[model samples]
Target: MKETVPLSVTESSEAEALFHFETGAPEAVRAALGLNATRIGDVVAVSMRNDPTRYWSKALGFGRTAAVTGELIAEVCAFYRAEGTPLAVLQLVASVLPEDWAEIRAREGITAGSSWVKLVAEVDEVVARAGAPDRRPMDGLRVAPVEPGDAGRWASVMMRAFGMPEEHYSGMAAATVTQPDWYPQAAWLGEELVGSATVYRFGETAQLFGAAVLPEARNRGGQTGLLVARARTAGELGCRLLVSETGAETDGGHNSSLHNMLRLGFRVAYERQNWVWQPAG
Candidate 1:
């Protein structure tokens, strides 16, 4: 059996390594976000890199982090200030830290008129099913191995599907394509490419990332089908589990589809919240 390491909250190089390995975010990005290394005990845990002030505040109990209802607000505020971006335009990826939410909100100082802060919860789950290898049996849907030259087109589809900027999609596609163990593929409906997903192998588990379906092609089972295909491919490569992140909030049309994934047998492993904060004007 694999030995379980105890969680520690200390500043250690090992903490930095674990943070980067788990998040897959660039080291420069980590530094830019001001990720601080903390050791919980024997295990290293890295604080969210997006805001240094909040990190210190939460760790020390002062500033925005002092308030129970304002942590999320504070964190978002600090993030925008550090990045020099408008609060409304920033997109935050959710992480599993509920105790810090209030401190984050207090830091942001969200008001009734200045800016809108939305608390989005994402459902994290693992794929329990595998894809069918007998492609000839399935009708109308064609799952093909993505070619090296098709990276650009695949990136385009991903950008549109996730509502992300072109740079992020392009960068991820380029990085994924060059990895020997990374498996990427596209889902075609008739002759049109509708969805795409990638599997990244990490030890005994494989993570499903970049799953997206074009707006015009959703609800035709494209996203779901692609997930199954990716899972099957991961299983074939000796991965025991496949995991993906989905939204839990239902305020938007996009989040409504999360119900479908849950109905398809994906259980919620945990819920993560994205905290936002903007500088005082």
Candidate 2:
């Protein structure tokens, strides 16, 4: 008889820690933002890097966390302002805070951004689902681990896929793949690059991040191919679990990516609040 594998606990605190570790890692901090960009305090205040749009430039575990005070918010805002970031963000795990946390954030010039959902599943579960017969067939798509020479192409594809401006998109994609902790994958159809994704490995878990599919390639299995490729790659690298985050169902978008994640056997580990801070103009 075959043995059944046990599911690992997905504690909200652990997920929060994972988020911080990824954002504060030496390789990530250096590559995305640059040297000497973090201001450590009750929460880690990070300087904006290539993500000028305020999507990825935020203080990890900010006011939403325990022991974070108004004083700390002031300090964090000061650091971001010093770095010349036009806006600041505080990421709060919904499962970790009081119901009125949004009001607290509002009192400090912080407002809610997109609601984010964190999902996790066993590596084996993900790997097993990769070859399911019911899965969409990618007749001509090819996904492969990327080489340094492919940075520009990857960035270009991501720019078109994510609707990011050329300069910011290129800078983010190129710098991210160069990080020691990141492994990038590229999907192609014939001579054209169609998708991109990266797995950021740390300890026993790897976060599947930066996955994007070119507009022209939607509904053609490019993204699913990338997910399967990442799952296999993570397993080969000895990672025991896979974790990822996307916009929450309440965020008011179609959320096709979140649906795809569910099809891969990932479950919502928790939800988090994304708080945005716009400086008075």
Q: Could you give me the TM-score of model 2 versus the true structure?
A: 0.80
The weakest ten consecutive residues by lDDT in model 2 span 1-10
Cα lDDT tens digits for candidate 1, 116-180 = 12211111222342332432233467677788877777767776676655543254454455556
On residues 1-281, what C-alpha lDDT tens digit does candidate 2 reach at each position? Answer: 22322122333223333344345444644465532245455355555544555554666644333555566666776677666677766765554445555565666677777778878877889889988888778868899988888988897787678777665446556766676667789999898888988887766777787789887777788888888889898898898888887888763558888888889988886677777876656
Query: Considering every candidate listed, which one attains the maximal TM-score?
Result: 2
Cα-based lDDT for every prediction: 0.48, 0.69
Quote the positional error of residue 169 for candidate 1 in Å.
4.0
* Model 1 regions lying over 4 Å from their true place: 1-105, 108-139, 165-168, 249-257
lDDT of 1 at 89: 21
Q: What is the alpha-carbon lDDT for the whole of candidate 2?
A: 0.69
For every candidate, C-alpha RMSD to the true structure in Å: 9.3, 5.0
